[model samples]
Target: MIFVNAFLVGGAICVLGQILIDVFKLTPAHVVASFVVLGAVLDSFGIYDQLIQLAGAGATIPITSFGHALLHGAMSEGHEHGYLGIAIGIFKLTSAGITSAILFGFLTALIFKPKG
Candidate 1:
């Protein structure tokens, strides 16, 4: 049930992005940035977390999720880190995901040589 809901929600978001790109001619970067901002605004209002609870990675894998992670990190760190919270906070929250991607990228690159 959870997986089904996540898949539907995540797929819908991705489909929306694809449509915007194809029909409206929005660039991927613009769509991504817009989604992040939208997510941040929604998160600040306490709506995004509830949505995430319902959708799981549906809400956590998109660029919007990145914004949410940053906001969550900042809020958590603000309790202890003061003004420096913003910068350090995002890093702390996203480090694991970032590290995993970097590691996987390095492994893939080592395994597959590219032609220039």
Candidate 2:
């Protein structure tokens, strides 16, 4: 049942992205940014946490989850450390993901040649 829920929810999110690209003619970058903002907004209202509870990996595996983690970390640390915590918390939850992206991108660039 959990697997079914995860599959359905994840597929629905992907379908929505496709609709944005095909019907609304948004570029992939625009769609990605929009989803991130949507996730942050939902988290601000505490709706995203509920969605995660219900959808599990379905909700956590998308780009939107990055936004959710950003806000969640910031809020959690902000309560303890005040203004500085906000800056610190922003990267705390996302540092691993960001680091891996940079590492892989660098490695790929080293291996591949770009068109002139």
Candidate 3:
């Protein structure tokens, strides 16, 4: 059941992205940014947590989840330490993901050459 929910939710998100790219004629970058903003907005309204509870890793593995994590971390720490905490907490939940992306991207760049 959980697997079913995860698959459905994740697939739905991907389908939406594809629709944006194909039908709406959005660039991939635009779709990515839109999803991130949508996630942040949903989290701000306290809705994304419920989605995560319902969909588990399906909700957490997307680019939108990065926005959710950023907002969630900032808001949590902001309540404790105020302004500075907002800045500090932005990356707290996302540092591992960001670091892994940077590392793997660098390694891939080193291993592969782009055609001009």
Candidate 4:
């Protein structure tokens, strides 16, 4: 059942991205940025938590999940460290993913040249 939920939720998000790209001619980068912002906004309203509970990684593996991490980290840290946590906690929580993304992107670029 968890697998089913994950598959359905993840597939739905991917399909939405595809529609934006194909139907609306949106760039992939724009879609990615929008989803992350949407996730952060939904989390701010306390709505995204329910979806995360229901969908788990299906919710967490998308770009939007980066926003989820940022807000979740900020709120958690804010409790202990006041406003400073809001600025620092997101990096503390998300740096690993951000670092890995940069590292792998550099490696991929080094290996694969873009086509003209």
Q: Work out the TM-score per prediction.
A: 0.85, 0.91, 0.93, 0.85
Assess candidate 4 and give its lDDT: 0.88
Better by lDDT, candidate 4 or 2: 2
Task: Using lDDT, give the best candidate's number.
Answer: 3
Best by TM-score: 3
lDDT of each: 0.86, 0.92, 0.93, 0.88
Model 1, range 1-116, lDDT digits (tens) per residue?
Answer: 77987899899989989998999999999899988888888889998899789999888887788777778888888778887877678667778888999999999999998978
Candidate 2 clashes between residue pairs 3 or more apart in a chain or in different chains = none
**Candidate 3 Cα errors over 4 Å, as ranges:** 113-116
Ranking by lDDT: 3, 2, 4, 1
Candidate 3 lDDT over residue span 1-116, tens digit each = 77888899999999999999999999999999999999999999889999899999889988899899999999889999999889989998999999999999999999999988
Candidate 2 backbone overlaps, count: 0
Query: Model 2: residues >4 Å from true position, as ranges?
Result: 112-116
- At residue 54, what lDDT does model 1 achieve? 95
Better of 1 and 2 by TM-score: 2
lDDT of 4 at 33: 92
Candidate 4 has a TM-score of 0.85
